[model samples]
Target: MKKLTIAFLIITLFMPKQSNAQSNGAAGAIAVGAGLLAIGAGIAAMEDMKERAELTATQWVLANHPELNSFSLKTLDFNGKKTKDMSSTSVISFKIQEFSPTDNPTLDGKKQILLAFTSYGWISDQGIDFNKVNWYLIDSTEWLNMMVAYAKVASKEKNETVLKDVLNNGLVVNKGIKAKGKTEIPFFKLEGDMYLVTDYSSEMKLVYNEKTLGIFLKDTGNLVQMARAAVIDTHEFFFLTK
Candidate 1:
């Protein structure tokens, strides 16, 4: 984790777009996030390192998400054909709140557990492949972080006023913003210090920074940014900003 922290600090220090000004104006924030993704892609070039990083990341998710102290992950081939030496597309869907393929039916008709690694598209043909191969776990809600991601975006887009007026500062779970049945889940909360913690009921912590929308897995007091999940402009009712 020290290694990743050093990497993060280096990135934060060197990131050129640390300003709020952009030709695109307020829209620049999205551009800034995009820039960060490009920076992450440029940070490495090793299969072994990528594997270890992904595994560590998976462990973090297991520990923090859905109160799972023990879980297993397996490498999947993705069974796709268009593999043309690091394509820009990912076989695994990076869709916000992505669900399992409906066609992949199960005997009991329950939704299959899926914790897909979505960092490959960011890595490109020459970078640290955090998830070199596609992956999915069995019977997992670990991906609910994606839903938390939607709340993050909505907090900025549709509900920006709610955040600034009500939650500009508050304790974590102790001070949560209530949701309607449309977006209510008893487990979600805006943890103090701005980490949007989802699994508040567990010893492990699954948090997403409202500032960066970077989802992390926390265990034993260490935080690791395993993935960046964002919903740019599409809200249930709001339109995209120009």
Candidate 2:
């Protein structure tokens, strides 16, 4: 785990910077325009209904789960879309860290989970609302455990279907729906039991309801990769389950 963390940090440290330079040397102008455009677009596309719902959810999580108060919120653009055209779609991420009771004596009395929250959304064409597509909450310890469990299960069973089944059915829990606008938002709950057998320093899991939409691993991988690419030596990586 330490090696993986170090490797990720090293790669991030040397990653290319996001340049806005253009061929005509109007880079600064273009950048300023783009920034203003994004801000304007965001404001113009703002949907009070969605914002209220998101705020409600965020407030509920913060008030109910005080342990997650330290987590940060962030916004990002989607890079995997085929069209290079700019859109109102954006991603929001939250991250936190969890340590074992024995490892951190100070926090031993507190909850055992270090939770992170991240999500993705798009601004409507009308630019009056945001359409959220994906969201995730994870415990670092649980994530480490799950990875180890996956490796072990894969080595033993070598069956992708079975492995997927174990991950989707046995390890993950379907939370209820979150009403946002006209859409019924699906959510999930996860536990540490799924990854306890793995030799990981911690355990973590993310959940989403399949009745509304299927969560894809590839999307999760992309989010992780993007977060890793942006920050070096920082355990706070952004991600979403679907």
Candidate 3:
């Protein structure tokens, strides 16, 4: 009788121990699955945030201005050097002569203006060498056209703050200000020490101070006078200025 009682007690303890082991294993499996799901949710949230940021930036730019159509990015040599060709990431190329309000209007209008720009080359052992020609023509013609259009709108509203912001931000002045008049017209001395007129009409010849920036006006007439200036102080131009 004693032996049977001892055997029964041992059996009861052993059964419960096995059952508890199985329960713990099941709980661990569920916990691991929950952890993986949490990780996946976090990753999705990050991607969503990135997309929202990009969309917000785009909307802000479009809502503020109009009269710009089809911005693009292209690689070109601006410095007249025959270095290795490189790609520009966000070079904003707009259609000046082609842009019309009918086909593409501002965000305020029915149509939403597409604003795009390119980024330049990456930093590496070989530094960034974007062809200067690419920037020159666009800066002179297309970029200027957009600025002129924006200026017209700003001037119509008589918004000096907006007008100044547009000129200072849109117009790429490579040099610091050489001379500024109190009458709201700002003159810049380029990196090459060439003087440029920023607030003139588009029909005037684009002229610069030869001594500093060394920009030579090919044509001297009414049309060229109105051409806007993109004065930059490059690495080479800075040395020349000193």
Candidate 4:
């Protein structure tokens, strides 16, 4: 019973917005809990949580969001193990389908189902903290366009300018940010010495003064070979400011 209480406390404290995995939130607690529990049960706990999360998320979505019934379900990389490395936060994303036939397509007609958890452990969406759990939509077409622009720059077929347009436009189209036809690269401003980690498999990590802020961007390998370069260029940028 005490262990269960501890787990609940862990879950409450770790609930993060968009699974940012701050120095004080989700990543730290889950990493410690997983490490201690693994000594006795091996590394299955995290994987089990992921599986349960998928089941619960699927059910919850179908029940609450009938509009997505026809779309396919796909579980995205949640960065559960990478949380231990502090390279990324744990976020579960499900891509709904090939295209959006709805009267209002999210982005060129595509939908994304996203759910965030405080830990890798499976907790029913009902039992989980509502503040952390989120079901949102992303413009898949715009995101793909950004990736294609990056590929162009990588292959030397186009300059960074094209990529920049796609990324900034994505923000306006998907997020509805009031940019007023301007380029706004999402970046974090931190104080003190900064540490930049570039892990191709993991999301981009922004560490400041030895504490991890969170994963700034996903699939950063496509942005640029080095994370710093991605932030420095016009077509692509992470925008880490001091």
Candidate 5:
């Protein structure tokens, strides 16, 4: 986490020495310093949030599914997909380094499992949106195909509508569709237990198979505990079953 220091700001302000130079140089320095501070603060906040989320995920695994602890955890960057706007997600990818006795046959055979979480201030005052936290079993072939598809569109410098059209109808996985035995979304083939976002208050919870699993609050005090438990439980319910 990067922080802006008062000493740095003061030094920047004093770096301008002459009469005319003092006014313009000091103003420019102040602007640059302020920009740097804002960038630093933003980066620090993002890092803090990711750490908190990861901690919460760890707690969930430890408390409920000690068996899953065998799988190594890797935290990825904040942006799941690059966009021109403020939209982004924090990602955590779990990989099974080796075969384990407790591993789910379905999950253990795969390369990696991904968990993507995000919070949008415009959507709700609540911290992380449970529904927005997505889990997926990574299929390297499908992923690569999607990436190549996207790259083709990107290379063409297509307009936004064209790009969206490609995403909506370009890449089709007949095998995924047949295996899923359902209609597929443009870029995604939905699988596993589905969940809906029902609460946005100070506390967050998810109800699945008639079981409620959370009293998670929307703050950093118990962030690790909240996130870890929620993630592990959710994965067990959704991803593990798949």
Candidate 6:
């Protein structure tokens, strides 16, 4: 993660020293440096939030499903994703499930199963962005950037229609919609005055026949104990870090 961050800093350093918007070299440097500084600071803050969210997720796993102490985990970066992308999730599966649960319906009706999790945030004319797509594939990042672009147009030209257009765009983009046959998933909401501003973390569960699989322990005795007892003893599941 730090390596990727270093590359961002390097990009800022290599930006052109002169810009037509600046009257002189000193002015240009000052303006550019200030923007870069804000971006870098915001990135650092958001990174910290992401780490905190990950730790909270780990705790949830331990408390609710201790067997998953060995569950494979992965933290992925989704900041650069565009609205057209289809990768809404990442999954982790095991090689075997010899300790299948009775009445389990996965892996030949055995308890062997697959698991997945998700987290997302967005860029608000700043450096940090989180990505998730579940609708017509629009994401917070794309919508925010579009609003800013339209705002710039209205600001520069002072057109009432431009402002109205931007407002309409926001309405269409963010207005909530419902999907059929969707089951409620468990999630953690991370929102505050600091880095995460807006985001959520979740582990996807599969529901069918009044039971959920894929890492969901539906109030059956001590969940952590059940997890610990049935989980795979291999490298396929682990707590991965940046």
Question: Which one is best on TM-score?
Answer: 5
What lDDT does the true structure give each of the candidates? 0.37, 0.34, 0.33, 0.41, 0.40, 0.32
Q: Tell how far residue 215 is off in model 2, in angstroms.
A: 5.7
Model 6 agreement with the true structure over 1-242: per-residue lDDT tens digits = 76558657665664556544445665656766776777778678876755654454445445655554233332332222222323333222222222334564333311222222332332234532323212111123433333333233222433545443443332211111111323112122223221111111132122111111122222221111112112221111211111
Score candidate 6 by TM-score against the native: 0.30
TM-score of each prediction: 0.25, 0.30, 0.22, 0.35, 0.38, 0.30
- Least well predicted 10-residue stretch by lDDT in candidate 4: 233-242
> Which scores higher on lDDT, 3 or 5?
5
lDDT of 4 by residue, 65-178 (tens): 777645656555443222334332245555454455577554333445353433323345444443434344444444444344333322333445654454444332111111
Q: After superposition, how far is residue 116 of candidate 5 from its true place, in Å?
A: 2.1
Q: What are the clash counts of all predictions, listed in order?
A: 3, 11, 33, 3, 7, 7
Best by lDDT: 4
- Compared with the true structure, the alpha-carbon lDDT of candidate 6 equals 0.32
Q: Across residues 1-242, which tens digit of lDDT does each residue of candidate 5 receive? A: 11346546545664555665666887867876776676667667767766766665556556655645455454543343222223233334443332455635333444444444444431244555554554444444434433333333223333545443433333323221111434333322223343222233343332211111122224421111123333333233323333
Please provide the root mean square deviation of candidate 1 (C-alpha atoms, Å): 16.4
Colliding residue pairs in candidate 1 = 113-140, 172-191, 172-192
Scored by lDDT, model 3 comes in at: 0.33
**Model 1 weakest lDDT span, ten residues long:** 233-242
Q: lDDT score of model 1?
A: 0.37
Candidate 2 displacement at residue 73 in angstroms: 4.3
**Candidate 4 deviation (Cα RMSD):** 17.2
Residue 122 CA error for candidate 1 (Å)? 21
Q: Mind giving the per-residue lDDT tens digits that candidate 2 earns over 1-242?
A: 54346545554544445673354346545555565555555444444434544464466567566765443332222222213213333333333333344432332221222222233333334432323334445454444344334334223444445444343322221222112222122223334222112222222222111211111233333222222221211122311221
* lDDT of candidate 3 over 1-242, digit per residue (tens): 54346445544433333345778757655655565555556556645543543454344445543544433212111122112213233222222222234555432312211222223442234533323112223333333354444333322424555554445433323232222422243333235433444343442222343212222222222111111221232211211122
TM-score for predicted model 1 compared with the true structure:
0.25
Clashing pairs in 5: 56-224, 56-227, 56-228, 57-227, 57-228, 60-228, 60-229
Clash number for model 4? 3
Q: How would the candidate models be sorted by lDDT, starting from the highest?
A: 4, 5, 1, 2, 3, 6
